[model samples]
Target: MDETWAPEACTLPTAERPFRVAEFDDLFATHLRRSERVDPQTLDLTLNPESRATVEDLTARETECCSFFTFTLTGTTELHLRITVPPTQTAVLDGLLA
Candidate 1:
């Protein structure tokens, strides 16, 4: 991984209340639908369903190196996601705005 692409430190807010894994999925799906810049293929989620807890939330903040995306699943909220745009698709994303 390139040093420039390293993820930055960030914190996400805890969910208002406890929710099941399925509830988290529904929230994630709704977020995806509302965001035009986000693609389904680029958003890959690996959640542990066995460990259930209350409070599910997410927060994003910018850093000096790269933008940080974090998810708060259950009580623990330290999930860091690193997203990479392939050379081929890089052009596609750029062209969309241009």
Candidate 2:
């Protein structure tokens, strides 16, 4: 993915980057259950129990770089992370999701 909007140049400061990387790695490695495309530019992701805090923190920081994305988390028993992007950014998101 090109990630032109959220280029590596916009990554968090060095000290924070590692922690974010570790946090996302943990989320992907153990918390994420699955991901799906709910619409042309929307992604519906399922996460395991207890991932709310991590997902919130991650998405909060993500918007700093990629404001085009909108993250909405919902559900009680099962959590869902809804990531919505504009039509102009769908291809970039598709590459990321791929």
Candidate 3:
């Protein structure tokens, strides 16, 4: 796994993080339409409507390992995702974008 940016608080096993990251990269490559950093601690993503299941699954597994994230997925036709982390975890969120 690429532990270079992964925070110490992440519970995802070191070996599995690369796979998780690959999934995210694939998701972004395939479905991400737009990405915005709403604030220092928040990120908003716009994805294709066809990405609902993938987003749901990825976010679910992500939260299981990094509970600090708060993800809200909405928009029936367009799929909007809002990801927020607490102030203390802002750096971790930034790592994801990198």
Q: lDDT tens digits, residues 36-90, model 2?
A: 8888889888898698887888899878866777888998778988888888777
Model 3 misplaced regions, further than 4 Å = none
Query: Which residue segments of model 1 deviate by more than 4 Å?
Result: 1-4, 7-42, 51-67, 72-98
User: What global local distance difference test value does model 2 have?
Assistant: 0.73
Q: Could you report the Cα RMSD, in angstroms, for every candidate shown?
A: 13.6, 3.7, 1.2
Each prediction's whole-model lDDT (CA): 0.31, 0.73, 0.90
lDDT string, candidate 1, 1-98, tens digits:
11222212312222312232234445444432222335622433333332233213232222221233223333233322323344434432232212
Evaluated with TM-score, which candidate comes out highest?
Answer: 3
Q: C-alpha displacement of 85 in model 2, angstroms?
A: 0.3
Q: Cα lDDT for residue 86, model 1? A: 44
Lowest summed lDDT over 10 consecutive residues: which window, candidate 2?
1-10
Candidate 1, poorest ten consecutive residues by summed lDDT: 1-10
C-alpha displacement of 57 in model 2, angstroms? Answer: 0.4
- List ranges where model 2 is wrong by over 4 Å: 1-25
lDDT of each residue in 9-95, candidate 3, tens digit only: 789999899999899889989999999999999999999999999999999999999898899999988999999999998887887
By the lDDT metric, which is better: model 1 or model 2?
Answer: 2
What is the TM-score ranking, best to worst?
3, 2, 1
Higher-TM-score candidate among 1 and 3? Answer: 3
